[model samples]
Target chain A: MSTPTETDAFEVDDSSIERMRFYGRLFLGACIVATLVGIVALIALVFDVVVEAWGWLTWEFLTHPPSYLAEHYDPSNYGDLPTGPGGIYPAIVGSIYLIAMTAVFTLVLGVGAAIYLEEYARDTKLTSFIEANIANLAGVPSIVYGLLGLALFVRAMGAGSSLLAGALTLTLLILPIVIVQTQEALRAVPDSMRQASYGTGATKWQTIRNVVLPEAIPGIMTGIILSLSRAIGETAPIIMVGAATSMFAPPNLTDPTGSFAAMPMQIFEWAKAPEDDFQHIAAAGIIVLLTVLLLMNAVAIYIRNKYDR
Target chain B: MTANGPQTVTTSESDGATSDDAMTDDAPLGSPRVDDAVIESRDLDVYYGDDQALHGINMDIPERKVTALIGPSGCGKSTFLRSINRMNDLIDIARVEGDLYFHGKNVYDEDVDPVALRRKIGMVFQKPNPFPKSIFDNVAYGLRVQGKDDGDVEEKVRTALERAALLDEVEDQLDSSGLDLSGGQQQRLCIARAIAPDPEVILMDEPASALDPVATSKIEDLVEELAEEYTVVIVTHNMQQAARISDKTAVFLTGGHLVEFDDTNKIFENPESDRVEDYITGKFG
Candidate 1:
């Protein structure tokens, strides 16, 4: 009524609009920088490792063992034949052995505990306390597991610094992960499904075995794959439990119980050496480790995509 | 909607005539009990925690008969149906009192197992909940849980699907996921799953409520056919559906009290209780 003025119709403030744009740009810019940092770091690591190990990624380097004599060592020399110094055959075999043992032991212990906790154990004060303690154990340092393995399995248990000791330590280290993952998998199954099974005259154990486990298998497998990848890359525990890098070749399926050298321990030993050749071999070892981890993660991703729906 | 006195019908005890033949053509099939009774519940009461859902309810459910329970929202018709199979025991807070007899056996006995009870008495829910498996596997689930692994599972699954009136549509897509089916098809698949184990009694809690008119008619026909073998008890909100399908009708009021139960036609045209009459007439629910 005072006066139909144009400024009265337009009360928008330009400064506030500019402030909003400023925050939006700040957020977007921060995200872009963080993403670039991750990509650049990954590319740099890949380039450095690939360049260093280019000289050592030959068939000879893969098929022979580390030589004891310097005259015949020939670290950089690939002789006439396809064979050469320092084949990772022992380390590969040993890593597989360690991983298998870790898987079996961890699955048995972890899934068993999970089943008891989720399906059977009463959710009382004691059970809650135990659950909290297990979650806390997951955050404990990996090196602390190594020290524990040395104290318990090696000295007290008289297992020595053998593959068994290393396997046991790695198993304990990943047991918490498996337990947590298994619980999550079990929990993901709908309560109605369980009721349906029970309503069909199936007993409690029968319901868990037939219905619940089948539904949770994919999730459990994904957890197992991820855990195995971490266990394969674990060095501190194995080193603490005395996995020697000097071992030529340790064991196979037929002799699965025998002691062996693992890839991480071998890489650690080679990386500590001052020679440039040893560094190249260490880089190659790292590449192999990365390959295994990549394969495991790929399998996990494939399984998760296939069945998590 | 004032309360009217009970209209006492002076029909003879021997008069077994149904009030309307249009809806009562599909009579259930079971061993003809010279004394016609399948389930007998006496002074039944259902409680959830401290709250009582159903008061004392006494009724005789005839074998191989379609008995429809109708009520307004929050009525205890579903609760009454669940009590027959002891399905209420599944709820942690639920408590049941008095006696429910199935084939003359006390379902609430100390030694009685709810799982065993449910095996004889299967149930279908309002919403379709087919397992996230192939159509064949979904039907075979009930049998599989019973350890029927003779490889004749396929034949039984087909038979059940056929009985549920879904075989013609899904026969070609046996391997397809059950969830891929339309809502009505999925509901029929659930019905097939329920009947696959050859349960003696099938309890449907608003089985057709989620379906459209066409799908509802299909289910109604399917239920009629199923009555030839399995004793059927259906809970529905649609009074017309109850009149169209059920031989016997039970009307429950607020607080889970059974107000009237009689022939479906009688309950609709000339209900014994004023409350039931008012409910059916749309004066009150």
Candidate 2:
């Protein structure tokens, strides 16, 4: 190919410029439409759920456990509950317990693994292999993790379809995501900071603990919160790990090896029921789940903003 | 030379010669030294991976004086400076060969920890890199890292900032973030941080290259003042800077060879090598 002459290169083609501008606008329009598709669908779904749950989302509905007989339900008979169609208080409590446990387990394991990989691991084939495997694991189906948890925690450890088993399953499901995000957070800290610490005669661990970790904490916190939000919404893994669809009482917070129920599991059961009232109850349950997720995201944003510098 | 002229040392006395003596014997001759040398390198070679960055560098830096390493880009001046404190150890590909002595002890010996070596030799970089913490914390970082952060931390930090010529500007705002300062203030903050640990020597890699003219002059003044209390080795691209502030100047050429090492006046006005003269007169790098 020959290079363009100076004169030819300097000359601007108006038609071609117009055509390029038109194509750029077309691409922008396409991107806007693509974005609006997801946003509109989400808004429509949320609107439908709010409308259906408007009458059912009451203090009684929130504070009482689910009951079988809605017409005969009475506040005075609260001692003997689950006989009348009441609320999803037990499910909410169970979900919170599962998420909290999952958060602790995943945070410890994920941050530790990330620190090892990013800070200590040498650049070799073995480390690259481990890194690649972790990335791949993040993309694996949640049900596969559920099976692993079922085999390891539920059967081998004899946790017996309890809150421990469910939380462990969710932990496994989101561990890879947490690890990957934590690695990103750690890597985002500038190498200059590490050099500064080391130049001051700080040992390797001292540098990491003082300079690296402090700078990375905000990013790590955001990653943990986002991963916890994802884990809280996971239904299939919890189901596979044997979360109860309905419960009269919340799981014992101090006892890990006890029966549990989760919001998604309760919603699934309610949505599956033939009664229309149960469907409205499921919608209300969805609203509660969404609110938890929104709160988690808000916390993540707040942390990122507060400590961003 | 005047009575208080730059301390000049001659390296051509070939007595007790080793194989490395051949390289240093060819180096330019200069006046006799008055001050005791604090750091010495014998036929030091540095490599980044398989590429040699410094070739047979041999010199002794005098105590309590500013020694400037000046060269064009890619001449390994920075590499030599980093080698003194083993800051190059941070790079996995970097390798060092030959003896680098501090107080008659070879720093590259097996038992000498790089961390311990660095405690006595602090560094400042080209860019002003103050930590994302308060100004007091930034200056106190080095002391805290060395576990010297006891009751007198406030007094030591103030002295450090004062020596760095930054205390007057930031006395009331010690709790403000170091990153909030201007470029010159930040560089001084870094200098204060380095001095807070009370290191015997400070290595600076083009510390004023990124600053404006006013900031650069301020840094130049600080460097001269620092030499009163600590030995300082600096790398610079500006020949004028090497002349204006340095007591001794070592000029490395394009091939990572130390072409001339002498008193700054001699190196600038009457270099022994034609290439050095050419470089000084701006005919060629």
Candidate 3:
């Protein structure tokens, strides 16, 4: 008279659950292995770079002028300046100017594009096309961006072969990356937050500025750091944009017309020399570059944790 | 209104196909009079994309009182409530037709700004959602955005928290992150946020659905008190909450139909519609 389940007083079986235990452990082990692989490689690379550059990392090496001849620039044999006065002061100054200039324009353009794509843009063909192009642009080679900088910033805009030209090219190369990341950061904000803001009667702009932007600050900052880091170390793009390999006097940082020498350009030039000392100086320059990059990422991580908590 | 049968919208007919019949129109059932009403909906219909979620909703929400909308899941109870504050406008595909009158102004009027309307009618969601900020800043956010600049933010926040009955608990930790508070405390903090703007109406979407029994009772008690000062329209799946806190109760059924609405006692004691009786008696969802 009773149903099958009721008559049997249905006992729940635990036999089938045993496989989940095995599978879960397997997945966990797989994830750990993947993480260890990345960590080990990163540790090894950092250790190698620090070891090669640590001995050459002196105070004078950091603050001295380049030893290359400006008029008779020879790569194979150095005449008066074989080892070169080898401080990267001018390169450091030039790189800082490029970073600052790139940031000023890229942030304004990138964040705006992201907000439009995420918030305002309708799902039409044009928007989708633009979004697709942005994704593609992020994957475009850095050298092509350098060429773009030459044709547009150097020729069309008359910026010439200066820090402005290099900075502008680098900005073009990283714009797509910034837009994509900023959009992701904006998207990560829960719709509930926007609803809560609107429920309080805030306007669209008001909600974005007050609620959306504050919550997305961590993600936005991470994107900015990542893009700037890429822009700061680039060699081919800067070289194509007419960045000089060596300049004895510090380049006019503010003037867009003056010639420039970035750390990568200087390092590339020195490392090309036959003398071993030039290689040491180049490695030291690399150490400085890595330190600058690490500091930027540290600042980003600190800001993210402060707000994320 | 049919006593047992629940009317549903059919795809064959266009808009204006459903009956405008009112079941609770019997003396003092809907309201004492229209003068006491703050918000009124006439033949309100809501559509999400091509699908209709609410049909022919006509009701007068009394001023300074809590009116609860109760029904089974996806019965358009929340949809109807969101329509009142024009919160549905936030959805890209949601469309609301018919007039939603708020104190004689059509909320959907071309000239009416949705932003301005929202400030007057605040909402607290089913889940407690506070900004990632200090308790004081969370409450002060709406005021600051309104450009109050009056330096009386601390005083206003205290008054609001006191009204929401969370002042004593959170007063000492005003500087602490709202996220750090317990779930119940965060829900209360959201209520305080809604009240800080001095809204004339408050819409609560199952405001205590995520809370424990004690917290649920606390929110129920807060709703009863809030009805004295603001027109509170709430959507809750819990009938007991509707009976306990609401001055009036509207029963939504399948096909986005409002089967019955009346004074809280009549709807519970002797529903005009048989479906309302069945729903109240747990006959069927």
Scored by DockQ, the top model is 2
Model 1, span B90-126: residue lDDT tens: 6767999877788877799998988778889988888
Q: How many clashing pairs in candidate 2?
A: 1
List the pairs of residues colliding in candidate 2. A67-A84
The list of candidate 2 runs beyond 4 A from truth reads A1-24, A70-85, B1-35
Each prediction's DockQ against the real complex: 0.34, 0.66, 0.65
| Predicted candidate 1 versus true structure: per-residue lDDT over A1-309, tens digit per residue | 256478665555667889999999999999999999999999999999999888666665566665443222345554543434656768887888888888889889999998898878866889889888888888888999999999999899987777778889999998888888998999988876776666566677878987789888898889988989998998888888888787776655565445678889878888887776678778888898898889989999999889866
Please provide, for model 2 over A1-309, each residue's C-alpha lDDT reduced to its tens digit, 9 standing for 90 to 100. 157788777555768889999999999999999999999999999999999887777677677787665432334554565455488899989999998999889888999999999999877899999999999998999988888888999999999899999988898888888899999999999998888888889999999998999999999999899989998889888888888876889999888898998999988988888877677778888999999899999999999999976
Comparison by DockQ, 1 against 3, better one: 3
Candidate 2 lDDT score relative to the true structure: 0.86
lDDT of 2 by residue, B30-110 (tens): 532324888987767889999989876778899999999998899889999999999988888899987888998999999
Give candidate 3's error at residue B19 in angstroms: 15
Q: Per-residue lDDT tens digits of candidate 3, residues A215-299?
A: 9989998898889998899998988888988787677966887888898998889789887666666777888888888888898
Candidate 3 lDDT by residue in tens digits, B160-262: 9999999999888999999999898899999999989899999999999999999999999999999989999999999999999998888888878776778
Cα error of candidate 2 at position A259, Å: 1.6
Clashes of each: 2, 1, 3
Candidate 3 second chain TM: 0.91
